[model samples]
Target: MTTLNACFRGQLGDFQLDFEFSIPSRGVTALFGPSGCGKTTLLRCIAGLNFLPEGKLEVDGEIWQNGKQFMPTHKRPIGYVFQEPGLFAHLNVKRNLTYGRRRAGIKSSNDNELHELTGLLGIDHLLERDIHALSGGEKQRVAIARALLMKPRLLLMDEPLSALDQDNKNEILPYLEQLHSHLEIPVIYVTHDRREVERLADHLLLLKEGSIIAKGEIGELLTRPDLPFGRAQDAVTVLDGQVRHYDARYGLSTLQIEGGTLEVPDQLGPTGVYKRLRIASTDVSLSHQEALNTTILNRLPAVIWKILPTDGPSLNILLRIGNMGEGSPLLASVTRKSVEQMALKEGQQVYAQIKGASLLGSSSTTQPRAHCMTPLIACE
Candidate 1:
């Protein structure tokens, strides 16, 4: 399997970073942490902007840096997108998009890639507009397109939507989803928002205080129970499903997932559209037996896979339905008192109750995997 290996030990002023980790070579891997956690610093290290003598970097099999050997930033096969578009104010969108390709000395007579990229970003119509005339979201889309045109082996995005308002952020997210589907190059996306991490990340790298706390698949990390991310009140599990049925009169949409059907709000989209559903652990309730008179819409028969102890009064349980290996892992956060009342234990069967309103939908392009395979790195 392809992978990007990174080992860096450095200090930026008062912050110290020492860790090594590997991420899959395709799909988005989010560098997530708090505001001062060295996310951007690490990103710059990978791009060769912040040269560290002790750093080591390798993508696939190519060595970009190690010891005394180092590749310059411009020479490295990387495309970087910052929080702001940073496009030339005097240039038109078309010009801005082509500048990277031209600078890279890449020649392509085929407008196929260009058309496909622009179409994926919803910027085909904006190509003729000047950079100054575009909205924040539009400019970011243009910036992303420009980076793609460079045909780099890796893409680095630094909070591309951080500067945009909610309306604009929503406008550009679908386009980012399209990139996830259409491109095979690896992406290192930096952000502090868990929502963005849930929607876009295939692999997750949790950085804190310049060190790695945990790194793995988003789903696995979110339900690990050992990680604080899994026990947070807003902790959620992402389920990949396709629209199975639509109820117009009741305004409900049913999604067919691996183990069972999930009924969400109907306005999600037409039948057959794939979506990533977010089910919060807090919204899930557990029962020893299935109830018939309950008002809850989604109830799945799950076997307790493992129960994890939280720092507080609550416990996080990982439940599996259907084939344990193939089923989407459901995380239910329940009180320790409830655990004693229900006599819940590993290997015991239970019912998972999920509310319809708790199911949040987002753009999904990839199929659900049995597990994410990000190699864990030990921190000193």
Candidate 2:
């Protein structure tokens, strides 16, 4: 299996960063943590900008750095996108994009590739516009396209959206999602935003105080009761499901998940199309038996996996969604009084009534798709 292996031990000022891990060479791997946690520092290390003598880095079997040899930043096949767009103010958008290809000594065939990339990023129409006239989101899209024009084996993004306002962030997110679904290059994204992690990342590396607290698949890490994410007050579970059926009459699509089916309110796509789902703990409720008269439409049998106290008055309940507790996990937050009133306990079987869910993004789209915030209101 292709993987990127990295190990670094270094000291910068009074702070020390020591960590080692390997992730797949495709999909987005988020370097997630709070401020001053060494996310950007680690990214720079991987890019050869902050070389450490004790560090070793490999990308898909190529040794970029080792004790015996060190590859320079420009020599390594990498695309770096910083917080700022860094576009040339005097250049047109098309000229700015072609500059990278020219620097890399790419041939005239880059014209066709550039056209395709610009179209994918929704910047083909803006190719003739000057960089100075573009919006924040538009400039960032051009920056991303310019990076891709160089055809890098790995991409490093250091909080590319941190400088944008909410409107621009929202405008650029779908384009980022398109890149995540369509590109084959591995991306190391540094960010402190949980929402961005939920929507874009396939793998996660959680850092705290310059040390790795957790590293694994994003879905598993987000729902593990022992992790900080699962214990947080606004914790949520992410699930990937395929559209099995769509009812045009009621405007609902049935999504087949790991161990069950969910009736999402939107027509996600044709059958067999895949999409991501986000279910918050607060949006889920529990009952000993399925309520027949309630307005809730999503009620699935689940077995209690674990129960833990939260930082607030409520407790976090982890449930395995299946008859024998052999399926996808779900989280439900309920008060201590309700837990006592319902006699909830580990290993007990109950029903998970999902109050709502958000459709994050599509896995099959070549271009950006508008995210659906439609609440999941029914299931069968």
Candidate 3:
């Protein structure tokens, strides 16, 4: 499988950044960390904005930087979107979008491509409007469109929604989600927001103080009890499933996942359509036996994988959702008292009762290859 290989080591003032990893060359790869963890700095290094002396970046077998050779930022086929829209105040949306294409030496004959992109972003109607006349969300859509028009091999987004208010963030998320289904280029998204990672990312790179704490597929990393994400207060498990059946009378759709089936309260799509589901750890409960008379509709046999204490009086239980204990992962946050009373232990069989599960969005039927990260040694 094709991959993007990156390794960097450098110091800025008193802080140091050192890491190495490889992810699939398609789908969204999220760089997630808190402020000052060097998320943006790492992104800049990848974009050639920060030239590290000991850095090597290879995107899908093409070497951008290695040893003495380096690719200049302007020469690299990259599309960058910053926190701010960064649109030209003087130009209308149409002109602003076409500017990148024109600079890239693409002919105006590609207008059909432009129209298709604008339509996907829901920005075709705003093409005639001035930059100042657009809302925060609209302006960002235009910025995204402009970047895509460059026909980049890789796209870098450094908190593109950070400048927008909550309303604007909500407004643009759907369009951003649409890109997952349409775009073929690899996207490196930098954000501190876990919500964004859950909604958009296929792979995750967790960073802390310029170092990678963990890197893997989003689903696997999110449910690992050893990771902070699994014990987080807002921890959630993301599952990829295909719609198998829909009952219009109850407006419920049955989804088949790796381990078991889930019934969501919506008609997601026709049979065989893929969708992503988010189940909160708090919404899951475990019982030794399946309750046949319960109000809960989704229940699956699972094996207790791990039990760890959280920041509060709760314990986070990691479960493998199948009778044989070899299936997709699930997380349940239960009170410590409940665990002590039930005598739950690793490898024990139990039924996971899910109270609610939300549909993140439709996913591509063809899943991307899992990300592969090289182990890093400490750099002195």
Misplaced by over 4 Å in model 2 are 362-380
What are the per-residue Cα lDDT tens digits for candidate 3 across 299-330? 99999999977888798999999898888899
Model 3: colliding residue pairs: none
RMSD of each: 3.3, 6.7, 2.1
lDDT of 1 by residue, 1-380 (tens): 54688888877668788758887768888999999888999999999998777788887788898866999999998889999989999889998888878878999998898988899889999888987789899999999999989988899999999999999999998788877866778899999988998888878889989998888887777787677776675567887677778888989889888777888875676677677778878788988788889888788888888888766788888887653435778888899999998889998878889974343334544344223565433223
lDDT of each: 0.81, 0.85, 0.87
Worst 10 residues of 2 by lDDT: 371-380
Q: Could you give me the TM-score of model 3 versus the true structure? A: 0.95
Greater-TM-score candidate between 2 and 3: 3
For candidate 2, write residues 1-380 as lDDT tens digits. Answer: 44678888778667798878776757888999999999999999888998777778887678888854799998988899999999999899999999888878977743778888898899999999988889999999999998988888999999999999999999999989877877877889999999999999888899999988888878878889889888988999988777889999999999877678899897898887778899999999999998989988888889999997889999999999998888888899999999999999999999999999898864564222222111111111
Best by lDDT: 3
The local lDDT score (0 to 100) that residue 341 gets in candidate 2 is 96
